[model samples]
Target: MKWRKEEQTPPPMEESAVPDTGWATTSMSTGAMANWTAVVRWSAWGLLLAGPLLGGWALASARTPVTVPTRAEAPRAQPASSDAVAPAGFAELYVAAYVKAGDSDADTEELSAYYPAARSMSWSGEGGAERAESASAVQVRQVSAGYWSVTVAARITSSSKNADSGRVRYFQVPVRAAGGRGASGWTAAALPAEVASPTSSKGVAPELSYGSAHAPLDSDPAVQTVRGFLAAYLTGGGELDRYLSPGTTLHAVRPAPYTAVSVTQIAEHGQGPAEGAEAQVPPDGVQRRLLVDVEGDGKHTGSRPMSYAIELRARDGRWEVAALEAAPALAAPGTKSNSEEGQGS
Candidate 1:
C-alpha cells in the first residue's frame, strides 16, 4: 500500500483550439448588420424628406381659393310716409280734406286727391257752392285689424240762394287699409251717412212708447229723482249734489247762459229690475235709460225741440245721471259767425 501511493500522477491541461472560419464569419455578420442599419437610416431619411413635401403640397392645394360668379342684388323698398303710417291721423286728415270750404275748382281738385276714381264724381258739383264743415269730436273704433269705424260730430255751414244756415250733424264712416306693398294709407270705403235725422219742428213732442213689462217712466221714483236733478241743472242751480252719486260730475248737463232749456217729455226704453229685488241684478246697479225731449229758446231765436238720451243708475235708493247724449241745437250759428258760444246740449 505504501509503494502504490508513490506512483499516482495527474494528466496534463490542453488549450481549446480556435476555428479557422471564425474571423470570416464575424466579418460577414458585422458587415451585413452595418449594411442593414445603413439601409434603414437611408429609408428613414427618405421618408422624412418626402413627408414634409407631400404635406406642404396638400396644404397649399387645400388653401387655394376658388372664384365664383354672383348676380347683383335688388334694392330694398323705402318705408311708407308718416301720414300714411298712422290710421287715426290719416282718417282725420281725410275728413279735413273733404270738409274744407271753397267754391273754386281748386277745392274740388284738392278733395279729389283723397277719393278713388269711382268716387271722383261725388265732389263734381261741389265747386259751385260755398260749403264748410268742421268736426268738433271724432270717435274711432277699430272693428278689425284692417278696418275702422269712425263717428264724427260736426257743424255744417252753407250759404245758398234761399238762406244762409248752419246745423250740427253726425257722420258714420268706414275706413280700411289700402292694398299693395309700401301702401300703408287708409282709405274711406265710401261717403259717410247721417246718424240721426234732424228735428223738423219747434216744441214738438217725441212719440213715447214703453215695453210691455215696464211701467211709465214718469211714475218711477228713480226717474223722478233724475227729472228733478235735470230741472235744477238747467236752471243754473248747484243743488244736484243729493241726486248725483259720489264723485259724479255733470259737465255735459251744464246750462248755457244765453239759452233756456225745458224738458217736455221723458220716455223709458228698456226694462230694469225693481229696486231691492234680489233676482237678476247688474253688477254696478240697476240702470235705467230715458229719452228726454227738450225745447231750447235762444235770446233772439224762438224755441226749438230736440231729443236727448240720458242714462241713470240707482244707488242707495236714489237715481243719478250716469251719462248724457244730447242733440245739438237747430239754431246754432255758423263756425264763422261772431257768437259768444256755439250751441251744444
Candidate 2:
C-alpha cells in the first residue's frame, strides 16, 4: 500500500530597523580630544612659570644660615643621705671659744653657745691661762655620714713668760652635721684634742715653668719694661699708662708707699729672644714671661724684698706690661726648673 507524503515548511523571521550613529559619535570624540589638548597645554605653561619662582624662593631662603640653639645639660642630683660639705668653719669657731675659756661666769655663758652642757672649762681651775690669737681650719675629713674630723691651726699665747713668742698648735675637732645634704645644723661631737702637725715629704717643691738659666740683662727691653712698670706699680714714680699694654688695667699702690724700687734679678720662661736678639725688641705680638726679684726702699720702712710674676707683650717694637700673673705657670712633674736660682740671681 502507498502512504501519502507530508510537506514540512520553515517559518519566516520578524524584521526590525536600526538608526545610524557614526556621525554623532565621531563629533563627540573630536570634542573630547580638543579638551584634553587644552588641559595638557595649560599644565605645561603652569609648570614652566612656577619652576623659576620656586627656584628663586629656595635660593633666597638659603642666603642666611640658621643657627641652632645648644641644649644645656642638667646637673647631677646628689643623694639626700650624704653629707656633701664638711663643717670646717663651725669647728674652728667652737675650738676658738673652747681654748680661751677661763674661770669666769662670762666664759661659761660663751661656751654654752657651742656646748649647752658645758658648765666649766675642760681644764682644772688652777693655773690654766692660755689664750688663742687666731684659729683657722686647715684640714677637713669625713669619717662617716654626718660626721667629720677637722684639723684647726691656732696661734696660742701663754700668760707665763711667753706672750711675745706665740706658737701655732694643731687641734683635732670631731664635728657632727645633721639634716639632709649638709644643709642643716653643725655641732661638735667632743672636745678638741691636741695633735701633731700634718706630716709631709720634704724636697717636694712644685716645679715652675721659669727654667731658663740665662738671666735677662739690664739692656734687655723686656727687663727695662718690667723695671719701669714695677717702679710705677710699687712706688708710683712714673705714669702707668706709658708701660701698660693695650687693654691692661693696673692701679698703682695708693699713697705711694715706696721711695725707690730696683729690679734685682730676672728669670725668663722659655728661651727668650735668642742670645744676641735680647738687645733688639722682639717682633710685634711676641710675649715674654718673667719672674722678677726686686727690692723696695721706703722713706721710713727701710728696704724690703719682693718678687713678681709678670707677662709682657711687644707692640710697636717695644715691650709693654701685659698682666701680673696670679701664680706662676706649673711645669711637668720631675722636670728641672731654675726657679730656686730665681731668688738668688
Best TM-score among the predictions, by candidate number: 2
TM values, all candidates? 0.36, 0.65
lDDT (10s digit) by residue, model 1, range 13-130:
4444335764544335556878988999999999999998998787779866655659877876654543345456555555565665244567656554544532345343444253
Backbone Cα, N, C clashes tallied per candidate: 0, 0
Candidate 2, poorest ten consecutive residues by summed lDDT: 14-23
Worst 10-residue lDDT window, candidate 1: 336-345
lDDT (Cα, tens digit) per residue for candidate 2, span 227-255: 88988898888899999998999899899
Candidate 1's C-alpha runs over 4 A off are: 1-224, 252-259, 270-287, 313-317, 322-345
The lDDT, on a scale of 0 to 1, for candidate 2 is 0.77
